[model samples]
Target: MPEAHEDNRPLIERIAADIRKKIMSGDWEPGRKAPTNDELQRLYGTTNVTIQKALRILKAERFLEGRAGVGVYVRNERPQTITPAHYIEPAAAGQSYRWLTEASKRQQRGKYRMLEVAEVTPPVEVARAMRLEAGGTAVLRSRIGFLNDQPAELVHSYYPIELARGTRLADRRLIPGGSPALLEEMGYPTRSQDDEVAARPATTEEYVALELPGDVPILEIFRVVYSDDERPIEVTVIAKPAHRFKMGYHIELP
Candidate 1:
């Protein structure tokens, strides 16, 4: 057994780690039902609540899944194999977020559903994320993006159009282009960012766009991209069917 952490780890995290070890070591094979809560409590010497907490973490990480009325089981695909951990840098082929954002606003070859595009007063969190004063006017863009007529993803993007003057973003034709690239072209290049990813249930819009059944789960990604000058510019909330999309990243070690 590995030495325990000097600091007490969260019960869920510790349980999650042990379960991950079993899966990685092939002690638990894909599609195999993990031990029951009572069994886990015995094995880990913990309470049902602790076991549930751990299982929830695994579920969120896509390592395991629960069926209604059925017990938890290892995912059909090895989580490591299906979970996206790599990011691919698109060819420096001149991408523009403005154009993409605008393109998304327009109806292209793929089917689309615009939830709402009303100018509204942003909440404090939105204002903080966009670096704008609270209650300021902003454009709320919510739409379902599709490929081959299949719902690929749902995008909720907020922009400070009040600050973006003399740009194409206001025109709403942004497509096949990237919003980050567009900002760069408009003299507000995105230099760095913070992002978070987790598995979640489909919202009403997501279900309609993805044609998702009640049981199907979706992946949610929250991204905030900013400029080198430390100014916040874009906050995008994305939702996609689990198997329909993949996230890629490339990291270099020093």
Candidate 2:
């Protein structure tokens, strides 16, 4: 017997873990009916209550869904893969609107709504990333991006007021070719970028905006773009539903 099957953990926990492994390994595929409680009880020589408890655990983790009169089954939804190269490599090739381009490649429609654009006091973190003085103002461009009509990400881009004044970045309309192209035209070509990622419970506004499930966490990405001279050109904050994305990176070793 495998050690996991023989461990001293609670029998219900062990049973749940076994079923979870099977589901994840595709031994039991999505939308397939899970073993009935009676069948699990017989196989494990456990009581109905014990089997029920195990099923509850899987349901809570969104691995299974019960149809009451029907039966429990594995969830059909899967996370989408998001590799760093999807954005970075394209940008390196001078392709703008990378997000939209990626969506189109996946046969999904991508669109964005420019929510707001105004000169506002920058958030402390945004100010620090843009190297602005405390309480300094910046041009804020807020947008909501959608994939196949589903909200996928909320992005807020900040630019130094002096750099953005009278520029498309300060406009309330969608900029053709994206902001990067406009910045390049203004002599601040992007040279490099840094990204910081983290996960946390979604805020109320985020939950509503992304139409996310209760208690689901969100992936937060802070990206800072710099010019050839190392002057910060832009800072963008992105919020995405955690389950909707799987971030990846590729690096070469020295």
Winning candidate number (lDDT): 2
User: For candidate 2, lDDT tens digit of each residue in 9-48?
Assistant: 9998889889877775678887898888889999999999
| Model 1 worst lDDT run, 10 consecutive residues | 82-91
Clashes of each: 20, 0
**How close is every model to the real structure, measured as TM-score?**
0.54, 0.78
User: Which one wins on TM-score?
Assistant: 2
Angstrom error at residue 237, model 2? 1.1
Candidate 1: what lDDT?
0.67
Over all chains combined, what TM-score does candidate 1 have? 0.54
CA shift at 231, candidate 1, in angstroms? 1.0
